[model samples]
Every structure is written in C-alpha cells, then in structure tokens.
Target: MTGKSEHDDSEREFDYRWARDAPHKEPSARARMLAARWKENPPEPVPFRGEPEASGPRRSSWISTALVLGCVAAIILLLGYTRFQAPY
Candidate 1:
C-alpha cells in the first residue's frame, strides 16, 4: 500500500480544487493606464520601403555554357598530351 494517509490525500485534493477555482484579480494601475492611453491615441502603422527593382539586363545563359565547354576541352587536351608523353 502507498505510505500516504487518507487525510493527506483529501487535503491535497481540496487545495487543488481551491486553486483551480480561484477568482481572477483586477488589472494593475499601470496596465489600465496604458490601455486607456492606447484607446485615446492608437499608433499609426509605419510604411515599409519596397524592394528595389532589377536595374540592368540579366546575364545570358551562353556565358555559363561556354565556361563548361572550355573546361571539358581543357581536360580532353590534357589527357591526350599525357597519354602521348607516357613511356610504354
């Protein structure tokens, strides 16, 4: 059996119920003052600056194509030169 007595269990249950049903307290003076001030003069929304538009023409795809073709050509030429120079 558990060590706790029936009295202790009832006391804990009563405390829990009391805390759960507790009344809500009134707002503090500072909170009420700020709320009143906001009601009197609500703040205006500040306008955000939009992103800048693209100023110049976009780069062409041919530049990247040419770069890849040049790399492949260089690799091919290097392999050919090495194969010829290697002694049998």
Candidate 2:
C-alpha cells in the first residue's frame, strides 16, 4: 500500500520550471548555417490567391459601387415581397 505522498520514492521527478538565469549557449553549427542560408536566399512572397499582387491600385471603384447597389436592390425587393405578400 502506497502512503499519502505526491510522488513515490523510486520515481524521478521532472523539473518543469524554466531556468531563466541559465547562461545562453551559442547557436549550433546547423542553426548558424540555416541563418546564413536564409540571409542569402530569403523566402519569396506568398502568391495572392494564386495570382501576383497588383503593383498599384489601378482598379476602378465602379465595380465595388455596382456590387453595393445590387445588394441594396436585392434587400429592397426582399422587403417589398415580404411586406406585400403578408396574409393579414
């Protein structure tokens, strides 16, 4: 029968505390090589939805305006249909 202690005597206790005051070791050779490689060849920018980003915002605002108008028209139609078709 085990006694009312947290851990058994034979069991090794794992230290979960971070050693904040411990000396920082130099980066490993592999880490240094990776850093150097990254410095030489940086990662390319991710493609925007499989397409390159526009160099400038040369796109006209008319498309967005038309979309907004279409949404408003749909909402008006829905409201009108619901109001007029009510079984009062």
Candidate 3:
C-alpha cells in the first residue's frame, strides 16, 4: 500500500531542471526602498583622535608600584610579629 503511494507522489513531484535556465530579476520593491533610504541618509563614521598617546616618558606607574610594595610589607610585618611576639 505504501509503495503505491510513493510511486504516485514521485509522478506528481515538481521538476527543478528549469530553474537553472531561468533569468534573474532585479531586487524586490522593499529591498530597493531600503537601499534608496540608506543611500540618501547614510550613517556618519565615529570621530577618532590621531595615534593614541604614545607610551613615551609621559606615563608613570609609581603609584601602582608603591601600593604593591606597601601590601607586601604589611603581609611580611604581620607574619613576623605573629611568629616572634607573644599572642595577646
């Protein structure tokens, strides 16, 4: 029973060979309208400054270095006091 139905479907199926020779048409109406609007009012490019400030002797990391050294010194002091001094 299924085989007969399959044969009938195969006979009624659409042929796709003609699509290869069909001529292509221009863009759809909606696409043309959108393109025209974009062409008439395109978006502006974002403003950008020249070469970003060079890393020349103009920048300093002394503050960051001092903070790190301070943290290390505090940790070392706490450890030494805990080991050598009597607990309160």
Candidate 4:
C-alpha cells in the first residue's frame, strides 16, 4: 500500500499544504453578534488553585508508607540470605 497508483507526490503535498494553511474566518455578521452578546452576559468565574493542605498531608503519608515498606522488604531479604549462608 503506497503511492499515486494510490496517492503520490502532488496529492500528498496538496493535502499537507491544505491542513497547514487553511483559512479560519467568521463572517462579519456573526462576529458582530458575538461581540454584542458578550457585552451583556460575561464569562463565569474560574478558580485556578486547589486546597494545598488537603493534598500535602496525603502526599507525605504515601511517601512515608512506601519508604517503610521498602525497608521492610530489604530486611526480609537480608534475613533470608543469612539463614542459608554456608558456614566457613
């Protein structure tokens, strides 16, 4: 599955250029209508920040638990190895 017997040089180039340089223009009447509507009913409020303390404690608890588990696993592995070591 390949070129102009299918789709080759000129067609492929045309498609690429069409996507890159397509014009986007709203008609003048539509633009004026939008401006008039916005002049009366403005946009709604948007809060950008979250509750810092709410997330902070949870993140710290997760890190602490992960560290504890990792230490416990390492200790278990060390004990297992010691139990099987050949005495010299």
Candidate whose lDDT is highest? 1
lDDT of 3 at 4: 100
For residue 17, what is the lDDT in candidate 2?
50
Q: Residues 31-71, candidate 1: write the lDDT tens digits.
A: 89989998999876756976678989866899989999999
Supply the global lDDT for candidate 2: 0.78
Clashing pairs in 4: 4-8
lDDT of 2 by residue, 18-42 (tens): 3344477578899999899989898
Q: Each prediction's Cα lDDT score?
A: 0.83, 0.78, 0.83, 0.76
List per-candidate RMSD values in Å: 9.8, 6.5, 9.3, 8.0
Specify the poorest-scoring 10-residue window by lDDT in model 3. 51-60
Clashing residue pairs, backbone N/CA/C < 3 A, model 1:
none
Model 1 residue runs over 4 Å out of place are 1-58
**What local lDDT score does residue 70 receive in model 1, on the 0 to 100 scale?**
100
Using Cα atoms with residue i matched to residue i, what is each candidate's TM-score against the true structure?
A: 0.35, 0.42, 0.34, 0.32
Ranking by lDDT: 1, 3, 2, 4
Off-target runs (Cα >4 Å) in candidate 2 are 1-18, 25-33, 36-58
lDDT for 70 (candidate 2): 100
Model 4 stretches with alpha carbons more than 4 Å out: 1-14, 25-43, 52-66, 69-84
